[model samples]
Structure formats: C-alpha cells, structure tokens
Target: MTPPPPPCLACLLTLLLLAAAAAPPAGAICVPRNPGGHSKPGAPAKPAPPKPKPLTPAAPAPPKLTPMAPGADIVRSLCLKTDYPDLCMSAIAKQPQPQLPVGKRLDGAGVLRLAMGAVRTKAAEAKAAAGALANDPRTQPLARGPLHDCVESFDDIAYSLDQAAKSLAAGDRDTTGTMLDTVRTDVDTCDQGFEEREELTPVMAKHDAELAKLSSNCLAIATAAGLR
Candidate 1:
C-alpha cells in the first residue's frame, strides 16, 4: 500500500503482534514464587494465633493457732502452782481439759479425776513397754531380768492408781494419798532393782526414767488439786 514496507520492518511488526496476543489481560495480577517451589496461591496466610490458657487462683493460708474454750487455761495455771510445774506444763498444756460453764468450773476433786485418767494411761503404757522389752529378741537376753522387775513395779502402780480413784470417789482423801504415794515410789523401786542386777542396760535406765517422770507429773497434779 504505502510504498510496500521494508522486509526487516515487516518481520519486526509480526513479532510484536504475536507477543501482545500471548500476554495476560490488563487488571490480572500474579504472585511471585520461589524458584522450584510448590506453593499454590497468592501470599500464604499467617498461621492462626494460639489460644490463651485459663488462669488459676492461689490457695488460702492456714490458721496459725486454734481458739481455746473458756476455762482452758485453768488446768495449766493450776499446774504452775505445783512442785513439778515444769513437768506439768510440758505434759498437760497441749492436752485439752474440758471446760465447764462459768458457774461450774472443775474443783480440786474434778481436776484430780482428770489427772488420774492421764496416770492410768501412762501406767498401761509402762506395763506394755516392759512386757515388750522382755519378749523382744534384741532386748530379751540382756534386759529380761530388769524388765521383769519393771513389769511387776508398773503393775503395782496401776493397781494403786485404780484404788486411789475409788478412794477419791468415796471421799477418802487419806486413802487416796497413801495409794498415790505408793505409785510414786514404784518407779524408784524398779530403778533400784535394775541397778542391783549383774548387768545394766541403757534400756533399763531409759524406761525407768520415763516411768519416774510420768509418776512425778501425776503426783504434782494430785498435790496441786489438794487431794491430800
């Protein structure tokens, strides 16, 4: 037409038309990807955030001391007036002595009854201790003789304590005093018997010491309560 185009110019025009036809439409967008990668889409969405854990409350503190009932201190204060005040406080302070209402506080006899209950428990324990030592293989050979004496001595204490309880109930303080006095001596008698033996084990001394302490505590409680 317009003086026929040159051969080189015609060839270049043909290449431009082919490239335009192969290109994507206007408004079409493509995401760039890593070379040799397998991702299928536009930008990968961020992973969902982790859920939060539930909160827990701390536990409350425990109380340091327990409240006492009225007249609870009476037992301890009465114990302080005895010869074995230290012993009484150590043995009885932590133990609860039932408190009476204001007009009906425990009198001397009532306190003595409480002391007797404690004494009987110790007596039974002493009896069982000696019996156990006498039978135990580790202690039998070396401690048998002394343990036998201890058993008998503690048995007498138990009997006397029981009799004293009856005497106190009968309003016979004199008899109760005599019985309690014997109970105090019984512990010493056991010790003396052990010392007289050909062999003395530390076990003998140890148990006798405990028996003496228990008896002394009972005696002190009785005296403080004016049992005599």
Candidate 2:
C-alpha cells in the first residue's frame, strides 16, 4: 500500500501484538485459581455459650422445742414420801429433848417403815417412767439414754435404801449413813445426766427435777445422820 512495509518492521509488530495479548496490563488485577476464597465482610463468628454456675443446697432447720410438764407436783410427791417422811422425821426425832422415847423400838420401826416407803416410791417412779417412754413415739428414742440412766440410778438407790433399812433395824447408824450417801450420789448423777439432754418432755423434766431434789434431800439426811 504505501510502499510495502519492511519485512523486519512487520515481524517486530507481530511480536509486539502477541506479547500485549498474553500479559496483563498495569492496574489490572489477576484472579486466583479458586475464586471467592476470602470470607465475606461483616459476617461475624458465633460466640461460645456462657458457662453455667454451680447450684447450692438449702440449710437444715434446727430442732423443735419440747413442752415441759409441771415439775412442782412431782417434787411435792417425792419430798413428802422421801424427804419429809423419812429424813425430816428422823432429824426431828433426834432432838436433845425428844417428845417420844428415843430408845423406843416403835420409833425405830416407824423410821424403817418410812425409809422403805421412800425406796418403794423411787422404784415405782422409775418403772412408770420406763413404761411411758416405751409407749410414747416422740420420746422413745430420746428417752432411751436418760431413762436407762434413771432406772439404773433408782436401782442403786433402792439397793442402798434396803441396806440402810437393815442397818437402821439393827441400830447400826454408821452403815445406814454410808448407804444413804451412796444413794444420794447415784441419784445426783442420774439427775445431772438427764438435765443435759434437750429431748426431755415436760413429764420427763418434772421427774428429773424431782429426782434431783430427792438427791439433795438425801445428802442432807445422810449428813444429819452423821455419815458425811
């Protein structure tokens, strides 16, 4: 056309065209083999669920209050049978100027009878307490320890009282005083043990209190009798 292009110029032009077609131009981005490789923006990962707290258990309630019986009645009964009839009677009879003859056999016999009556009353009370404990549901378990102690104490007292009665009948003041001291000690121990337990019912408390009073009275009587 314009004077046919030079052979070398035409070849060079062809090479340039081929190179331009194969290579990417400046400012152009290249695609990866696997397209859409990157994660989308504003798509947040899920948060882990919060850990649970530990549970606590409720506290147990305290023991309930038990009602007490009238202690005065039991006290009066014990005092009348044991303290007033036996100890007080003997103490009064031992006055420097006796109303009745001091050496009278009837006086000694009467004192022995009073002592026997007191011992019998103590034994009866112990048995009755045991029976009541056996029959009562609420007090049965709690009563076992205290009731056992009370009965054992009563047994000791009864034994001592029996010995004392024998001594009194034989006019052995020394032996009688010793026996009374022993009885008083046993009864005191039983009373103290019973008082410590919180499970005592009114009736039980009354019995315990009465027994304690009896113990004190017996101790006084033993001392008055010249034992301790």
Residue-by-residue lDDT tens digits, candidate 2, 3-78:
9789999999999999999998899986544334454444555577999878777788888967532232332333
Instruction: Tell me the spans in candidate 1 whose CA falls farther than 4 Å from its real position.
Output: 1-67, 93-103, 140-142
lDDT of 1 by residue, 6-120 (tens): 9999999999999999999999987787554765666576677999888787788887898774444766666677666665555554445756666787666666666666666
Poorest 10 consecutive residues by lDDT, candidate 2: 69-78
lDDT at position 135, candidate 2 = 64
Off by over 4 Å in 2: 1-105, 199-203, 212-228
* Model 1 weakest lDDT span, ten residues long: 87-96
TM-score to true structure, per model: 0.61, 0.45
lDDT of each prediction vs. the true structure? 0.73, 0.58
